[model samples]
Target chain A: MSLLSRKIADAVSAHPQKGALTVDDDRYEICLELRSADPEIGVSFDGLDFRALDASPRSVETLKAWGERLASRLTYLMEPLVVLEVDRIGTEVELRSAKPSVRESQLRYYELRLESSGAAHLRRVLFDRDTRTRSTVPCTLGAEALERLVEDFTATAA
Target chain B: MRKIESDQNRFRQIVRGKIKSDLRKYITHGEMIGKTGGELVSIPLPQIQIPEFRYGQKNGGGVGQGPGDVGTPIGRSGEGDEPGAAGDAPGQHLLEVELTLDELAEILGEGLALPRIQPKGRANIIEEKDKYTGIRQTGPESLRHFKRTYKKALRRQIASNTYNRNDPIVIPIREDKLYRSWNPIPLPHSNAVVLYLMDVSGSMTDDQKEIVRIEAFWIDTWLRSQYDGVTTRYIIHDAVAREVDQHTFYHTRESGGTRISSAYQLANKIIDAEHPPIDWNIYVLHFSDGDNWGEDNRQCVSLLRDEILPKSNLFGYGQVESPYGSGEFFRELEEAFEDVPNLALSEIRNKDGIFDSIKEFLGRGR
Candidate 1:
């Protein structure tokens, strides 16, 4: 394999969750959510599709499946995945977990947020780890609203 | 196939002609902005019909040999007509042609007579890039220099006294292989900073906000295309100045008296702290309804003349006319910066005036 492909493969192996990527900018709005495994809450980028990125990752099968379902809904790709990583130390996901944690740069920003709680809430919704930028208002939407929007879009896509 | 391709090109030319003739109308009405995907933008190209050479029916008495009665409906069977019920003369057939965004931008640039921005900062930034430094005796032909290799082999053969005139077999030794060289130098790229200041006062209606939103998108598109890495900052003010997100800048509704100077102050502060004139080319664009506090005009004028204009590459004041606005500020700006080189002022009367205003603001190409 070429060096670039090898590196990308390595990255995929190291990371969890990946999906298809589609490129379309027709009428679409991406709705994101912040939640943990316990709550099971998720968000959506309404009208955007992602079937193309389905096989890019190695170990992130679960993430890939979610991406598959999400990709099935839309006919176009809107934006590339903006990611954030929650480190083991102070991540919302880490904090919520039962296991003990240690020092590490686990939390990285896909998008930054206003407060820690809000940032945690955003990370959970967007399912990304890190928060970036100067303190800015975190995007807010109710769990029900997120699900409703996603479900409505999923129905239309079907 | 080549003829068909040429015909296709002619059709596209017709589509572009239609667009150019009514470019201002399209910009104003926000038509032809429907985007499809990369390399394809859906445009409502009007009245430009697809090329069709309809053959006459075999039995019809058409121009060439046919068997039917004299002039028995020369064309295709029938596009059925019910002659009445508010008669239908051939309805305008608008073909939606998908032109690349670059084509659209080029057309817009030509129609508006906008001067291309001369790139500035690219020459100054000390970018250290590695290129093949210089020729060497042995490297790879992906980097090979044939002349250098021949010269090296000839010189080596000559220097070592292996020169023979009878049989000139100057075979290149392993050491004779040479490679071309490259050097890394710092390249400069011009930088531009765009400061968008808007009035979030009560007088500015949602319609006005929508106008600003749409105009800003096109302005950004054109300006970003003009300059690499264009720095954009949003400042909104009602009675005071504050920074806001992209979403809030357009959607945030506030109800306070107008104080145009507040936005100016914030913009000036941003300029002072982040973008100095030496390192950055600054552009300040202010969108306001001319309803400033009567006493603040002098302060605004002084600021524009002294601090803002000096530091800015272009200081554009767009006075959006609103129902409640006195619109006195536009007149004041006209009188104040009448001969100013980089300062441009445009009056946006309504949605229809957006194209003209954009042209007026960026036409000088400062």
Candidate 2:
């Protein structure tokens, strides 16, 4: 569903942890900035005022209306830029064509990013969603280790 | 018979699809592991159920119609002459399917598109084992041949001129006993060892360790596929590090300061004592939340450069992004070892990035 920009603001305000939250599929690139409490993440994507989403009572309803149209309009078939942002901690997921490569549906490039908290939540969702596709791949180290911030990424051995 | 075989094959295909659809839950959820045993695993699949006849008399006219159907209730034949047992509940059934580990692995490979590992290093420790294969007069009683022992006893009794045709009873002394024997030959096999080093300081959380655990299992699976014999070692570290079993590796939590060097020292010690670079193909994978005591960061780099790198075939370092982590360790490694050939470093920002991280680290076939 298309919350477009407002859902992200609601997700961020609900939790101060950039890594702990993100609007599902709301994508971003978190630039690393040196800070006092370890390193903090700064996001790059649509800017929706965080204050307004919390203040407006009709935010969810408005988001639903806008998202429905947007979901229909934004076609992945055209090689659209897919940016996924999760409001759990902070993770920016972007899938796009790598440079100089011509656009072909099957040959397009893909990139994924997960802020720690956001990724942990995403794992629960994605791993659950993995039920839909029925993947044939073994959950091997290289593929699994590639997963982000999963606290129990090492669970099977346990 | 051919039709039945074809139907069974189609049923198996359906079961495979069901498994593939839920593969992620199966991977992430750990319930399936308990079900694994021997070479085959049983997975329960929900299926539709139907009732059928259990007894004879389909052709017998008087079987259900009470003697020749003349006064029988033939009016409601469309409704089925017999009054069946009534039940309101819908039929539900679960089908259990057995699959081998290799079959499971094949499905996994197809789903993930993982590259096969190319084994490296010189594995020269040839081993020889003997197995009981033939009957012999001299051998341990544990391997005694029952049929041969009886035959030899009977033959000895006859040879000693104590045989009787009417009372066919033959019993011989201990010398007539025969046992099984064995032959030994060298069997060459390749083996490997994986050393998993994890930084478990305050910066790292349980969530992060879970990720490491999942990744490690897959890593082990692929490596095991490459070599017949494989061993795994686990090391977890805080400001101080220690070598522990796999269980302790994921569960232990410490919160003082971070010293990446401690884990390396312990790993180096393990390699020196148990595995030699000449004998085993060693793969070292280090997962950290990317926080190291500033002064000790340099020490960690020194340890990797001087001690760890030389003894390992692939030295993989993954920086797990965390809220409480400094995240500068990855940058430091990038700056320090920009062109190191065997050094594989990756930045894991979240779970989705795991896919690419694995590709980048193992893509070179190390």
Maximum-lDDT candidate? 1
- TM-scores across all candidates? 0.52, 0.52
C-alpha lDDT (0 to 100) for residue A47 of candidate 1: 22
DockQ of each candidate relative to the true complex? 0.01, 0.02
The digit string of per-residue lDDT tens for model 1 on B136-164 reads 76566688988888888889988998978
lDDT of 2 by residue, B324-348 (tens): 2225678788889978878988876
- Model 1 gets an lDDT of 0.60
Candidate 1 falls in which docking quality class?
A: incorrect
- What DockQ results for candidate 2? 0.02
Best by DockQ: 2
DockQ of 1: 0.01
